[model samples]
Target: MTTKPAINLWSSSDHAAEYLSRAESVPHRTEGESALLEFIPPSTRRILDLGTGDGRLLALVKGELSERLRSEGTSPRVEAVAVDFSPAMLEAAARRFAGDPSVTIKIHNLDYPLPDLGKFDAVVSCFAIHHVTHERKRALYAEIYSLLNPGGVFCNLEHVASPTERLHDEMLSHLDKTPETEDPSNKLLDVETQLQWLQEIGFADVDCHWKWREFALLAGRVGAS
Candidate 1:
C-alpha cells in the first residue's frame, strides 16, 4: 500500500494561521453549517467535535442550544470534547473556551483511531478529516460509528473531491487559489465514497445532506433500536 502524506500543515503555525485568517471567507460555508445544525436532534446531551479548529462550530451549536433551552424554560447541560492535533489550533480552541467548564479541549491526531472518550449523542466535524488517508478515513468512520449512542448523529462538513480535474481547477480558481497554493495536507475523497463508507460501517440513514461545489455536509444516525 502507498503511504499517505503526513498532514504537515496542521502542525505548522504558518499553515494554521493562514487557515484561521480565511476561515470565515469560505463561501457558502455558513449555509452548509446551518443545515448541519438543523439535522442534529434537539435532545443531544453530549457532543464530540473532531478536528475542532478554534472551537468555532462547537461554539455556534452551543449558543443555539442554549437559546433553545432558555426559551423552553428547561436547563439542558451540554458536554463537549474538542479534539485537534495542531498545537496552534488546540491553544486557540482552549483560549476560545477558557473558563467554560462545559468544554474540554484535547490534542488528538485523527490519523490514528480515536481514544476512549465514551459515547456521545452527537459528533461533528468541519473543514477537517480530509487530511487523513482514504484508508484511515474509512477506519475512522467505523470508529465514529462505535462511539455514538443509539439514535445519535454524526455530521461532517467536509471538503470533498471534485468530479474531474477541470472541475477541481475551477473550484480552486473560484476560491482564488491554485493547485500550487492548496494545502498539501488535503487528501480529499469523493462524497459518494464517504457516504457509502458510513453506511457500510452500520450508520443508518447515511446521506450527504447538503453540498455546494466541493463542500458537503454528510450525516448519519445510529439506529435507535
Candidate 2:
C-alpha cells in the first residue's frame, strides 16, 4: 500500500544513514538545487531549512550566498536554522555546521506547527516534505507563509506523485527500487495540488519552479508587489 507508513523509520540511524549514502546520486538533484539557489534573493539575511537532512541543501544555499556577497566586496552576515526530527539527521547537521556561529540545528517534526523561530527571508526544504500527510502538508505551507517576511520566498525541492502508475513504476525502476521497498513514509502529493494549496494560503507567485520526473521545486512568495 502506498498509504502512509505505520511507523517513521527516519528516526533510526540505519534508515537515516542509508538515505544519506544515496542522497547525492538522485538524478538531476544538482540541477534542481541550482534552480533553487537562483531564486534566493541576494539580500536574504535569515534562512530556515526544514528537514535539513545532513544540512546539505542549506550548505549549498549558504555557500552560494556567501560567494555572491564576496564577489561584490560586501560581506554581510547571515543566520541559518537547520531543522529535522531525526536524531541522526540532527547530529549530522550539527556536526556539519559545528564551530560556525552562523548556523543552528534544531529538532522539529514537520507534522506539528512550526515553532516561534521568528520570520525568515527564505525557507527551503529538499526531498523531505512528502513524509507528512497531505492535510499537514497544506497546513505546513500555511505556517511557512506566515513565517516569511514580506518579500520572503518558500522553495521546496519535493518528491511529488506522478500522474500515472506506469510513470511511477518507471521512476522507481530508474531509482533501482520498487514500491515494495521504497520509503513508506512518503505521502506524495502532486505538484499542482501543492501549488494550489500555497496560492490558497495567501502566497504570491505560487508555481512549480522546476521539475524532473517525479521530483519538482515548488516556490511561492509571501507578498505581492
Candidate 3:
C-alpha cells in the first residue's frame, strides 16, 4: 500500500480568489493581527512577511512601525519583502503594494526552503504557514530563526490545531465551515509543539500571545548574540 500525496489546493486560482474574498470575515482575525503587531519591535527597520497573501499583515506592520517612529520624532522608514507562491495571491500582493517602493513582492513556495533574502528585524505571517507539512513547518521555523537579526522578532498569526476533535468541530462551526469544507491546504499543528520548536530554535520569549479557537498568535524574539 502507498500513502497518497498530500493535497494543497492553494495553487488553484479559484481557490485562492475565493479565500481572498472571505479573508476578512474569518472570526477574530483582526484581533489576532492586532496582537501580532504588538510583538513587533518599535525599532524594526527591515521586515519580511512570509505567505503574505494580499500583503495584509505586512501592511499593518509597516503602518504600525511608521506610527511608532513618527511619535518618536524620527524618520519613518520600513523596507519590506512580501512572499507568496500562488499566482493569484502574488498578483494581489503586488497590486496592494503597488507604488510603494519600500515593499518587494517575491514568489516562493513554502514547501521548499526559503531563498536567501538576508536578515530582517521582524518576520511575520498571518493565516499562512499552516499549509506546509509538519516537517516543513519545523524546518521553516528553523530557517526563520536563521534569517533574523539578533533581537529580531517572529510573529505568526496562524490557524493552529485544536486540542480535541470536538473542540475542532465547534470552532469550525463558529466559522460556519464544516470539516469537509475546510481548506485542503491546511496542515494545522498544535500550538504547544510549534512554541517548542521556536524555543528549540533559540528564540527567546516564546509564547502564544493571543488565541481564538483555531486562530492563534505565536511569537518569539531572537536573542542578541
Candidate 1 residues 115-149, lDDT tens each? 99999999999989898998998999999999999
- Distance from true location, Cα of 50 in model 1, Å: 0.5
TM-score of each: 0.97, 0.96, 0.96
Clashing pairs in 3: none
TM for candidate 3 is 0.96
4-37 per-residue lDDT for model 3 (tens digits): 2467888789988888888888788889988988
Backbone clashes for every candidate come to 0, 0, 0
List runs of model 2 lying over 4 Å from the truth: 1-6
Q: What lDDT score is found at residue 41 in candidate 2?
A: 86
lDDT of each: 0.90, 0.91, 0.90
